[model samples]
Target chain A: MPHREKTRILLVDDVPENLLALEALIRRDDVVVHKAASGDAALELLLAHDFALAILDVQMPGMDGFELAEFMRGTEKTKHIPIVFVTAGGRELNYAFKGYESGAVDFLHKPLDAHTVKSKVNVFVDLYRQSKVLKHQLETLERNRQEQEALLQELTETQEELRKAITIRDEFMSIASHELKTPLTSLKLQIQLRQRYLKKGDASAFTIDKIAKMVESDDRQIQRLIRLIDDMLDISRIRSGRLTVHPATFDLSELVHDVVDRFSEQLAAAGCTVTLTVPGPVVGYWDHFRVEQVVINLLTNAMRYGAGKPVTIVLEAGDGRARLSVRDEGIGIAEEHQARIFQQFERVVSASQIGGLGLGLYIVDQIVRAHGGSIRVESALGKGSTFIVELPVEGNRASDAS
Target chain B: MQANTLLIVEDDPDIRACLEEIMVSEGFEVLTAAHGREALQALQSAQTLPALILLDLTMPVMDGPQFLAELASGRWPEAWQRIPVLVLTAISEPFLAGGVAEVVRKPVDIGVLIDAVARHLPVSLS
Candidate 1:
């Protein structure tokens, strides 16, 4: 997939003249050549750099060609490189004996044959090229293995983070439950104590007022805590695929009316009005309870953003899909947040003034999908936003491919 | 220093405040803290060391396991070691109190909390 490292060929000869002569013999691209003038120099070169082969001179001062060849063969690093000797006017048996004993692959005579050197060197070069390819392949595999290990490590880290998140969630649940219990206990106690005190003429005006305030405060706290716990449990059930749906055919218009009736107080508190317009009857199959949950979540969202503006719920039917649209006039969804609003655990950025866990739209999306339906949101930053949920009439029987 | 007082260690305010009210109305001197670190600190400096510690499983700084780890090695101040810690938590894993002395579940009745404290040692109401 990428480029390769160059090949290095080292030539060793005692005489400078022979070294120069040998260097000119072979010229090829993608090959690097190094020459050494003596056995010691050749050994130094071998230590400094890796070579494919050492071309040695048979005649030398301190280290004989045969001795150098033996040294190259003995040492661990230099042993693998092939050795070829250059000699002149020697007996055939002596030459053959020296070559084989000293570990020379072959000997070339001093009246240096250029073609012969080129041909033999080519053979070693080809061998060098093949080994390089194998080595490169090994390196590539190693790199890929390292990358895979890093990815696995990252995945493990993510899993650990998720585990911590779940633990925090569980801890929050326990604390929330305990908190709810305390207030409920206080409320019951206050109510009982005040009723007894009144019945027994033991209730002073001060005592009665105190107990009343206590009951009111504790009741509010209990309600808030209960709602939080319910939301948490709902998300947990939805995520684990444990939430069940009770499907039935119902008039979509009636369901919307009930949802509106339930949310009347919330709408008033939020200073928002609601309006609904629908056809006489749009028949739809859905889990009524879950559909109500979805409707409430959408209404809450509308109330939050629509703030005093009328949230309109319009139901229409066409192409075997029943469409439900909720329009809000408050600060509409920004383009960036619109994309992510349907993602689990995503909250609107910088909207902390409104308290939410960012799971409402996500839950809505899931409910819509389970009914073999789709939802689309259209919004601009400053203008009002519209969310349309379209459901198939026969959601339960729809084929997966469709 | 009184020998009988109930200790409660929890990071959450509502949980701590609720438990404090429960214990105080039950006529026991109650001590409270937000986490294991502060609990240990309070334990070390208290004019009256508590007879029992109601420990939470998780907290802000050091958690239940870390506290137990520290306590098991006996690295805590000597006075702190002798306190019988009742590991009050929502987690049912009583084994989380491996090195600690006792265990109790949260959202338990105030009467149950009092009995748990009374069973270990007499608590000071004075």
Candidate 2:
């Protein structure tokens, strides 16, 4: 409906006067006429332009009207254009049958009737316009179908991803509930036993040494409960996108030594010894509290899985980056579990009865990445695992999305 | 056979000690293990099989279900099968261990546990 292009007609004749007369008679404001004095000239025009109809003079020097019409029918590009043949022959000569046989839509007699020529040309031009509109509409419909198919594919993929996320969330809730209850169970049983002993007025059970030991055991359970609750809080903070890094200048070696010293009691209880190897003061600008958290998590994991073996901590600074590594010579992660250990609630050692919310490594990874840093692990089954974290010394790198 | 003996298998040291203390106070001989594997070792070397086995489901090396499976595999004496095994677990899901005399969800009620143990013992402590 929006097409504004003029309808074109090509007129070919050896007689220059006849070509001129035909073009003049049919020319209108919305029509364009082209005249060619020979078959070869007409072919050049036909190959260059898309015409609605082609009218050929029957009596020509080399190629007659019938011959030209046959050539047009044989070529792929020009085969669909309607052709009208003009002849000087009378009605008895049966030129109409010959014209139709040569792929002509109609015939015109010389000493041509002006009315017939105008009306016949009009009919063919109108048909050509309708076909052009139909071809455009079909192309638009095919394009729409392809776009819809692409949209459907995109929607299906998004739905599958959402389903997987929901499954992970459900699994996390179950594991969290189980983990939080274990220490509480111990605490509850301990309290109940003591209350029962006191109810019977047993003085021996409340002796100085026995009471001290009970207090120690109570402290251990309380600490475990507090740590589990803290992990859950951190997970919620991360979920709400509130975990951010606030940078400060500090000595990396000093921070590591401080955290390790604090864990001395735990290490001694686990029967594990720490070998700290810091060449010198490795200073950096980073979120001091968050970096301390990373060290604590890594050390805790090393002690838990170290099998009472020696644990090693190393710190080095070079190439504008500080690298920290914690190595444990105990049950190591398998090759298949290395990549998944940092994901939320993904405990590769679930069957081993290791305790915690399984959010330690995930939190560590997040904190490191937010500082524009990286973390990786190298381990094998029974060979021990080493976790390495690298942070920018200047703390000037752009903080990544938390 | 030490029919008055009870074997307490748990992963947590505090909980294991608590159970041992409670059973000892109730006039029963108690043997403790850190995990299923250690419990298995103790059973193999004991002078007499225990009258009852108190098991925790999740443990390092060998868990409760794994221990139950190994116990039912006919690798040990047939009399070991007759010993009532009570599962004490923090898990809320339906337990699937075979040949268990009772399943207690944690935090367990002390009265319920004592009554259940007393009911399963060949000779009542009272």
Candidate 3:
């Protein structure tokens, strides 16, 4: 959008006819010309709108142009506006000299020329128009810069807030782990003792059966709580920027296997077909735990959202980095929400119904970035989605596989 | 398995509680004292000799080094040297090699704590 601009000129002359002529001559679609028969009227006009230039007649009935020019020079507002005088043509040099002394920019003798008047007027008008354009552009640029600075400031504040939140979360996880340890420890002991006693008793007894069911439920709940606390800690490390990757020589194939093995139970429970492919023994030095975590999150998210859909795991060497990708044939990301897929709390609408806290991709992206790596996502609605991770791998070794 | 008694000496309540919980879970009869003075008194007066002492580096009264100095200097119970001393503090300043047996860190991980204690405890559970 262009700047809003308007040019205004104040014309002062005792002869009404002369004022009308000047007005009709200088009128253009872009300029607004105002006429004042008296010096007081001209001053009032100057007070209202900033004039581009003022035209004054020396031989006036009340206050002459020289007096008006002097008055204009005295006041702050009208002073900067250039003043040009109309002379009566006697002691031309003297009249011109006094005009200059009273703040006149130029002088024109009476019996005005039609062409000279139009041409001179056009020069000042063009100057006024150019300056107005420049001023408006400057104001716009300043406004845009201020808005940009405000946005950057807001971003900085949000980053700090997120940091604080991660700290709080870490504290909470550590505390929860401490609190839950006592009960879990006691329960584990109690259950072990109960198992010992049951082994000595009848294996098929009704009361034994009942006790077994209760024990199973209790054990599952304990396991779940432990998993929750552990997840919170890992995610906290990723969020708080405390998670560091220790790059070692390792096999990417083995990494994929570990990830798959960790979620084998969940995959079976979800009854999803999972395929793994890797020619990896790909070498890289990355914080193994964090990279492993990124893969785990991607796979877990896929399993939760993929439903009965097939999920593919691919590990490949690319551009000096070990790459791992998880692609799922499930509901795909929408066009509008794809850009912010890695942002926290932003679950794509397609996966909104899934049981997720929407932190998986955010954590994944963070973990990848920490490895000095990058992640990409490709999706088409209703077809499927693929999430890819690339990382530098130089010195790595495979973790033991069972 | 015979449960050996363990003494914990530290200042922070949160860290103290966390340590006790870990030791108790690992089947040790645990006793806790907050600082070095109280720990020394406990050592002088407790009915049973502890199997190990988990010491913290920084504290208000008679810090870890001072307490260790008094014990290791001379004329002290032989049990002091026998019991494995695991220093658990955040300080990373390198001292003379083998100043203490092992140094665990702050923000204790349960697995690490259990493993450290189990490794240092001399008598294996039957």
Candidate 4:
């Protein structure tokens, strides 16, 4: 409630002298008095102000004290105001009963007792002030309850997110253990076999061709271990927001060509070939090393799952963006698995068959995003997949926006 | 004398190669398959039943458990089911498979693996 300096009371009487006398008795610096000669005029005042009390004269020319009190009772805004009826009649006339019937809190005789009137008005004013203070306190409590409810809802959502993160962490640990153990097993067995030959004094096991093959096998396993460890490091860097993109101007076509040229030996080993469809020099400003990493990841995936089929690389640039896509016609991913492939440790095929850490596409996605670029896949089961990436031509725009 | 033959079923090419090399050096004729479906095909077409089998649990197109279930479904001769299978795996869970004689965790000790294979063989390799 707004702070009010004075309490207001209505005084309605036919004679101006009677109203003035009553007002003088109850009026104080903290009290405001409104006087009216008729019931209609008093009602007008009643509708305009919130009064603490209303004292009505019984013998008015129109609308007597009892009738005015009934009117105030019927009105929603004025209904709660305490009514006091002042009449010149004696106790035998029973005006007090009628005044009480019309909802008057008290009755006053025309030979008004000044102390009683002043004291009654003061009591009503104090009651109104106390009720207003109580209402203010109730509003404060309701607002605090609502605020607490909102905070509890936020906490529940955060807890659910934390639970999901922990599950992912646990799953990643298991997969990592399994993948790392595979190469270690191969290495251990190879070395044990060589050591046995050495113990048996078998010079035949160290023949030029046999030693070359052993070195090759060891190198392959070591490379596989190195690749898995690098992927794990990349994931940690991405999660920690430390995957920085240092942008520089370069031709995307040349980069694709270079990546393809480098992957030629791997492609042939997998019995796969590449088809490049670069119209011209599609140039852009992007992180050179990171973009090369993206290319290598995608191309490696293409060859790995391409089922010895031809892989296609396409590049185009226009309207401040460069688009690169790699398409393979091998065993494709199902629609449901396509979206999840870019997430951490997600693979469409079994780990036993493919022999991967399942972080290739995820790392590729993070690298692309760090360069203010986006990656998406269009694939269906057994029809093959096309991975598309789009990057902004502007240099370091991702960092600039942040 | 029963022929000393071993069938190896696995998907990873490198691991498959290593297993083949180890078995061949041990004076055993080995038949290899990339997955369960291929292993089944090889078994159906073979002239003689292998004395023992080495199986990896996880694979594409078909898996070890699925293959074992098929082998026990009366699709092949009763002699085929008699061939003991040694399950070699990296998975850290207890697996259930029909006709699995023993389970060996990978990074397997060669002596332990050989002893297990010998115990399941109809006639031990010389």
Please, what are the lDDT tens digits per residue for candidate 4 over residues B1-126? 545889999876667877887788888899998789989999998888788889987776677888899889998788888889999887776367558899988877777878888888775445
- What is the C-alpha lDDT profile of model 3 across A249-324, one tens digit per residue? 6677787897788667657655577898888488677777777778878887787667667889888887677777
lDDT preference between candidates 2 and 3, better one: 2
| Cand. 2 Cα-lDDT | 0.84
Off by over 4 Å in 3: A1-6, A24-31, A90-104, A188-402, B1-40, B47-51, B54-83, B87-100, B103-126
- Candidate 3 docks at the CAPRI level of incorrect
Clashing pairs in 1: none
Best by TM-score: 2
Candidate 2: residue pairs that collide: none
Model 3's DockQ?
Answer: 0.01
Evaluate residue B27 in candidate 1 and report its C-alpha lDDT on the 0 to 100 scale: 61
The candidate scoring highest on lDDT is 2
Estimated TM-score per prediction? 0.47, 0.84, 0.46, 0.80
Ranking by TM-score: 2, 4, 1, 3
The C-alpha stretches of model 2 lying farther than 4 A from their native spots are A5-7, A12-15, A34-49, A56-79, A83-120, A264-271, A334-336, A396-402, B1-3, B94-97, B123-126
State the fnat of model 3: 0.00
- Cα misplacement distance, residue A158 of candidate 3 (Å): 1.1
TM-score of the A-chain for all models: 0.57, 0.81, 0.50, 0.77
lDDT of 4 by residue, A1-402 (tens): 434645788999999999888888887887789999999999999999988888888789879887898888889999888887787898664454443554437777768888888888888878777776777788889899999999999999999999988987876776777778777778877887788788889898899999887777777778778878988998889889888888888898899999898667668767688889998987788899889889989998998788569998888887888899999998999998888999887888876566577899999999888777899999999899999999888856757777
DockQ of 2: 0.62
The alpha-carbon root-mean-square deviation between model 1 and the true structure, to one decimal in Å, is: 15.2
Query: If you assessed candidate 1 against the hidden native complex, which CAPRI class would it receive?
Result: incorrect
Is candidate 1 or 3 superior in DockQ?
1
